[model samples]
Target: MSAAHNASYLSRIKPGWKFGSLLVLSIGLYLISSWQVLLVAFILSVALLASARVDLKQLRAPLISIVIILGVVFILLGIQTNWLNAVSSVLRLLTMCLLAYSVSLSTRFSEMLELFQQVASPIRVVGGNPDQVALALSMTIRFIPELKKVYNEVREAQHARGLANNPLAVTVPLVIRSLKIADETAEALDARGFDSAPANH
Candidate 1:
């Protein structure tokens, strides 16, 4: 399980405020060209995450992946431009990713749903349904974890059979199971009369 699923003081903050803060920081960091400033921001972000009690172990894989990717990008940028610019760009990206992860770790799914609905509300005036949009967003978020679990389970079964190197060995069953889940979900929704509901006036 992820540290994001746990409750914390950061989770208790208003979603709108948190979103705004992250947006401002991301844009500000992106526009700045100073490697020193970006480095400081990354360090401070790590310190802030520590104070907020996010598990460093839970984040290790993602953090390392980001570093590896950035290292490649930095090498390319350095060859094309200069070392200073490459370093600063990588720092900015690292800072933005860290802050974004921090926000996700602290936020509840319900809070995320409400935030999406609020952001989507303007679409209502343009004949789009904010409620439906928010529902879709929430469902996607909820199902992603389930889908990951299913994929892992399938992968393990294939590995046990010594078919791990076979692409079809993993994907065929995954696709079939995913389709079955979708069908079941549609049926459940229909049984609940969601499809039969009358349009709002």
Candidate 2:
């Protein structure tokens, strides 16, 4: 998490409320077809991120990826349908991604884990381990940026070796490193007796 995110008012809001609102807003975005409304929603999402006071620099990589992906999406949709449809699709998706990222940035991992556990509690009735489920989800969310960092490091190293464009060279090391991290995490959880503990409601 960014220091700026910790200092923002959005950080003080409950994770459940922020996530709930994000879900509602995302659903609303999907239902609205007008490009004008979608554009406004995208603007509002940007404004929401601005209000959170998160450092834009931290978002550079993800923002770049989003732009590239959305550009491809726009082109494909325009080819299949109309340009207006492509515009609306891009705006709606971009808005949702921004809002989701904003929520993730502002909310702490502990808060997200607690919220996920609470939401997953009903799984216990079906003989499921809600704590494990919640932990898995939380860890997945928490490690996304870490994985991205690892990927960049691997890419940079490969680039330095003049193998930047070699898919196998990049992918082999990334997968190995990611699995190593996952194994370490599982061992740490086991040492903490996470599986032996009762679920916290």
Top of the candidates by TM-score: 1
Q: Model 1, 61-115: lDDT tens per residue?
A: 8988999999999999999999999988988898888888888777775677678
- For residue 180, model 1's alpha carbon misses the true position, in angstroms, by 6.4
Instruction: Assess candidate 2 and give its lDDT.
Output: 0.87
Off by over 4 Å in 2: 1-5, 131-201
Worst 10 residues of 2 by lDDT: 1-10
Candidate 2: residue 143 lDDT (0-100): 98
Candidate 1 wrongly placed segments (more than 4 Å): 1-8, 134-188, 195-198
- Candidate-wise lDDT, in order: 0.82, 0.87
Which pairs in model 1 have colliding backbones? none
Per-residue lDDT of model 2, residues 1-201, tens digit only = 433346688888888999899989888888999999899888989999999887678788998999999999999999999999999999998899889888888887778868878887888788787666767776888899999999999999999999999999999999999999999998998898777457567
- Candidate closest to the true structure, highest lDDT: 2
Clashing pairs in 2: none
